[model samples]
Target: MHCLLFLRIVSALEHRYKYFRFREDAVGKPGHTPIKKWTAAIRQLAYGGATDMFDEYLHIGKSTARECLQYFCEGIREIFGEWYLWKPNPVDCHQLIDMHGSVHGFPGMLGSIDCMYWEWKNCSDAWKGMYTTGFKGKHPTMILEAVADY
Candidate 1:
């Protein structure tokens, strides 16, 4: 969520979709800005919280938050799906390997990869033993791993 990247997305979304554009209410007061709308959407997506959790802070109702989430998903899918939502072809893989070699002096590791330990609060007692790594006094955690080519 770098400011510039967020602004770039906001600009694209605001330009492509009227719902994302700022407007005035009936009383001539400005309504929600694109930033607020995107923020609500991103929070719901990134945090997986209740839709109403940040409504007060964002000055939007639960329904609006829900709407923002739905539309944000749809807009992102429509706007970025073509380039990002596809399997890598052979040519693409080769290019990625080359790019990685050039950038990091590594081979075939064309992207950032990471693993994270995520605490699983309220994990059932039966599964707790399977989830932990014998760490004393620590909650059970699951490892989340991901690879990304940015």
Candidate 2:
């Protein structure tokens, strides 16, 4: 029972993450058809079947399947970067104090920064250094900083 419940929770989280990532406007070019078929194909391949899923759902050849998935990912990265690239706004102390007062039982924290680690495949020697950290192994990541004012 415990294992089943854990599996359900894991699946739900995975679905939520995937939905947020792919459903965002960042996944396709402006004025272009959305990459729903390609995203679904890649998800099916990664999570379950490659050939069967591609043929049944995508109706494309294996090589085409691979190409579509690759193209979709590259396009998504480019689009997302362009859309979300912005400088952080400076923090305002008065607004922060008011926000802290309104939300009772919460710590009066002015700002917060968090880091999330991801597992990535090893890369070439030259590129590895850029992706490496003092603690984690070779994985590419971006440091995102945001400031909120109440």
Candidate 3:
């Protein structure tokens, strides 16, 4: 996810969802939860990464990390579903065709596929050379190509 979008989601969840807020324990002591930990959990799950792999860096337990993932998914659906999750209508299709034709001289254009970089953290040293590509950077990153119209 983009950094700004991720931050916006975190802020929205923190304010709108009571479950994401840090709580106070006995004697008014603040709970140990940090919003970053929760964000990390959700990002990993969204990116198809292993939950336990983040335990070392985020200093979060496995069970708590799983809980964070669940809450993050639920909160995202509740908060951002209206604007982001929708089916295209006839008007939308017409607008897309017109816009693409006017801008790029192509009518009836849907979209194009592009490459995305993903770091290889657990890649073996011997295979790192094979995975290495100069497209994005020096790191051994797997390129993700996807097609999107909007």
Which candidate number would show the highest lDDT if scored against the true structure? 1
- Writing each residue's lDDT as its tens digit, candidate 2 over 1-150 gives 376754443343334344323232465643212244444545754554454445665454666566556655554455555666654455556556657668743457666566566544655565456656744644654344455444
Tens-place lDDT per residue, model 1, 37-94, is 9999999988676788785688788988998898888988888889779888888889
* Stretches of candidate 1 exceeding 4 Å from the true structure: 90-117, 120-150
Please rank every candidate by lDDT, starting with the best.
1, 3, 2
**TM-score-sorted candidate list, best first:** 3, 1, 2
Q: Between candidates 1 and 3, name the one with more favorable lDDT.
A: 1
Residue 53 alpha-carbon offset, candidate 1, angstroms? 0.9
Rate residue 108 of model 3 by lDDT: 82
How well does candidate 3 score on lDDT at residue 87? 76
Model 3, 42-113: lDDT tens digits are: 667666666765667777666777777887878778888888978789898899888878887778886777
Task: For model 2, give the 10-residue run with minimal summed lDDT.
Answer: 29-38
Q: Each prediction's TM-score against the native?
A: 0.62, 0.30, 0.65
Candidate 3, superposed: residue stretches over 4 Å from native: 1-8, 24-34, 114-141, 146-150
lDDT at residue 7 of model 1 (Cα atoms): 91
Task: Give the clash total for candidate 3.
Answer: 0
